[model samples]
Target: MDEEQDPSGIAPLLMAIAQQDQQSFEQLYRLTSAKLFGICKRMLVQSSDAEDVLQEVYLTVWAKASQFDAQRGKPDTWLTTIARSKCIDRLRLGGVDRHTDLIDLDQLPEPEKIDPVEFASDKQRLDNCLSNLQNQHRTVIRTAFLDGCTYHDLAARTGVPLGTMKSWIRRGLMSLKACLEK
Candidate 1:
């Protein structure tokens, strides 16, 4: 079993958290916050939003830690699940108002048209950079960005764990950034 699934370690910490032990809560936060934050950051796409989601995750943990059952899953998995849910909730709430304010296209200034040759060159370069990524990375990045899928949607479509899906997108973005920079 992976360290995450090892109940002997995490179970005790969680039990302590359930009992409202501040030190144990601190220890739990110290152990799992980075991984949880990474999940939030990947799903939310804004560091400030991710930070808010992370805080909400901990608050939920504080209230619901007593309900966590070790037999059901690992502590890390439990924590990450909460983080993912919080991030998705925030995403949905934020997206609700996104289309409410409409700018009239007729009233707006005209966009500058790009030169076709330059556009083609940029597109080709981007395609080349994307092609450099691993198949999994490329697929996740494209599905998430190009196709406008959320992390939740991508995980459901791919049948992968939400955390794994987030990792794929995050690593894919980093690889793309490096390749594009070169």
Candidate 2:
């Protein structure tokens, strides 16, 4: 079984969290916060907004940890679902107008137009760099960053070990960063 699915892993931590153990809560946050933050950032697209929603997500987790049941689902999935739900809620409420006076729409500045040739050049450069990677690294990097699959998800889907998947992604990202910098 994957460590994520092992009873001694996140499940035990969550069970402790359910019992109001502060240390377990801290451990859970430490273990899962980065993934949760990534999810928030992807959905919200603003660092501050994502950070605010992440805080709300953890608060919800702390309040609702007792609601988590191992039989129903894995702890990671439960946490991911909560994060998604909170992000969606934030999006839903985001449409409400807080301004007392409405500004004239005609007074707004024109949106900047991106140069398609420049955009395509960047994309082609990235594609070239990706083509230079080992096939597994390229595939894993694309799936994780482009598709937003979590490490556990990628590991389970690819039948690879979690640590290996993490290493692949880390190295792949570093290579991508180096390539992009040039």
Candidate 3:
């Protein structure tokens, strides 16, 4: 069990929130916001964007508190599911994959971002797992996926042949795929 929970999980907090209890919502945010923000920022890759999603996640939390089943999982786990689902929804809507690296971040029109749920564990298992990879492999994976950098970007940054960078990303992602599944 998460040590951070109130005596009865977040159930009491949820009821407070559902009843528009500002104080409980503040307490809940204090208790869980950091973990949730970490997940969203890692996936969304931008602080402002992650904050947008965080707001959405909280809105869902307030609206759907009754749906959370503590018997099925921890309160944190239910919160994370909502965060993750919301992130996936943004991805599905093509908001996440928008051409940022191509256009300068400042020049692009800001899109309305939903509560960002990123593909991350509620815990840091993903980081612990990723750390096991070689530094170069990690760089490739982060550049290709998280940073949304291009193969050209990788090649340019590392001074590797473009083809080589492509091959490395392909193989590296395959390794990541295997590791992620396990």
Candidate 4:
């Protein structure tokens, strides 16, 4: 179902699950398992491993259901986030080798096309703003935000001090904000 047509019943089910309700948890798995499984399969690239990760995802949900904050994000997004993180962890653990040859670009479905005019304008604006950043600032900001590296991770990977890394990101974001506001 399209997002607009999908029911909002998942929130209530999550709430019940938070309270240790088995029936509600079962209902939630029945409703979202297919979607979550698809995410796992796409990331892991193996059906058996995806099935294993999906089970781990639900076990995590069962344990951390109370941590779900509806005000922070929707139920589906929260679940998807959990599944994605679990998949990444599994990938990092050497469950899957990183090889570009394993993927066939031609076999992938085409991406939805965007309006050319809007895309050009947005890309130009973003490029202009990103260009305003100093070399180190730009690298730090892009690595942290785009690559999803934590501050400590960035510091360790680049051999820069943690405080220095944070300073670069903070200053870079401020500069980016001022540029984008133009």
Task: Tell me, by lDDT, which candidate is best.
Answer: 4
Candidate 3 lDDT over residue span 1-182, tens digit each: 34343333576787678788889988998888897887677667667877888999999988887776655667776887777676656655665633233322224332223332432352345565556665666666665454445677667767778898788777767776677778
Ranking, lDDT, top scorer first: 4, 2, 1, 3
Tens-place lDDT per residue, model 2, 22-114, is 999898899889988987887667778779889999898888888988888777778888887877677667752211222232343332333
- Runs of candidate 2 exceeding 4 Å displacement: 1-4, 95-182
lDDT of 1 by residue, 56-171 (tens): 99999988899999888767668878887777677677652111222232343322343344345555667788778877777767655422367777777677789998998899
Question: Which digits, one per residue and each the tens of the lDDT, describe model 4 over residues 43-143?
Answer: 67778888999999999999999998877766877888999888878866875632123222124332234334434565577667877787777776655
Residues forming the 10-long window of minimal summed lDDT in candidate 4: 97-106
Weakest ten-residue segment in model 2 by summed lDDT? 96-105
TM-score of 1: 0.53
Runs with alpha carbons beyond 4 Å of true place in candidate 4: 1-6, 97-99, 102-108, 112-182
Candidate 3: Cα lDDT at 166: 86
- 3 or 4, greater by lDDT: 4
All candidates: TM-score: 0.53, 0.51, 0.50, 0.56
